[model samples]
Target: MTVVRAKLGAHLHSMTAPFLFVGSGLSRRYIGTEDWEGLLRKFAALTPRPYEFYRTSAEGDLPAVASKIAEAFYDIWWDSDDFSSSRKKWAGSMEGRESALKVEIAKYLSVPPALTGLANRESLEIEILKKAVIDGVITTNYDSLLA
Candidate 1:
């Protein structure tokens, strides 16, 4: 979150405050969300094929690999006890066989992580940003941390 403080001040205006554009890094710093590849790797573990298989099959295209992984998870999600509650909650959104992977991803991200690991610098950054005069917060991330 140090970037929040640093960048917010750079474009301040007297008439109108600046809007902070937070990319995908906030979760990585605050909650340690893995990068896209690593995130898919976690889900890949549930499938019969290894993550490397998906990587090779997709020819290094992460989105393609994600889709393939989602296809794999669709088969597992319908029968796995691990996703029983998820199946009940998301049966509507699944559209018969799709979006189960997204449901799993949302479930994983929605669980709050422990904040005890916050460093002194990050704490100070939070304090500084709390007092920052800004028009609003914007983030590429889908989480509601700023919203």
Candidate 2:
């Protein structure tokens, strides 16, 4: 373990441009973001059906679950005559909930408190990541912290 760590450290130091590919776990740990199921459950609560129905129906297929939830959301949005002008306009322009899901995920993952004073709260791992001479940080994460 010590040897591997030393070798990895050497390699990281020598690399000119290393890209970090982060996932939702990083956000969950540092920013307290929900996992995919948790996010789905939250959105499902807004639908007419109970959250468990959506949860069980998805059977671990998040994209499909999101599509189902999106349909429900569209229905709600369509039936509501009380929406603000801006909201109504936005809903009218939306093609589907996929984009809206991305927006919602981004909002949930982006915790302002976690990012504030980041430089002052750097951990050893964070410091090492900072030391890497990277051309860019690539992530599938929806949050703007890495941006």
Candidate 3:
């Protein structure tokens, strides 16, 4: 372990511009964002169907479940004729529900101000990485933490 650490330190010192590939687990660990199942469950609660229907029907496919939820939300939003004039105009001008769904999910996953504590080892590591002269960061997470 000591040898590996020394080698990694040497490599980091020698490397010119390193790139990062971040995953959802990093945000989940540091910022307390929900996992796929948890996120789906939240959205499922908004629908008339039980959460388990979406959770189990997806068979571990989160993207499918997300699509289903977005469709349902779109239908609900479209069918509602009770919106105020301003809201009606806004809703009519909108393009698609998928974009709105993404916005909602991003809001949900955002790290709250109180959860920004960086005293832990994981956060410390992220801080170090932020200070490094990296070339770029590639992440699969939908949140804008890297930005």
Which candidate gets the maximum lDDT versus the true structure? 1
Please say which candidate is ahead in lDDT: 2 or 3.
3
TM-score, every prediction: 0.81, 0.65, 0.66
Candidate with top TM-score is 1
- The lDDT-based order of candidates, best leading, equals 1, 3, 2
TM-score of 2: 0.65
Worst ten in a row by lDDT for model 3? 80-89
C-alpha lDDT (0 to 100) for residue 91 of candidate 2: 52
**lDDT tens per residue, model 2, 51-120:** 6676567785777778777766665545555434435446555666564545444555565636444544
Native-vs-model 1 lDDT? 0.80
Q: Deviation in angstroms for 40 in model 3? A: 1.8
lDDT of 1 at 108: 81
Which segments of candidate 2 are over 4 A away from where they belong?
Answer: 1-15, 79-89, 97-113, 116-128
TM-score of predicted structure 1: 0.81
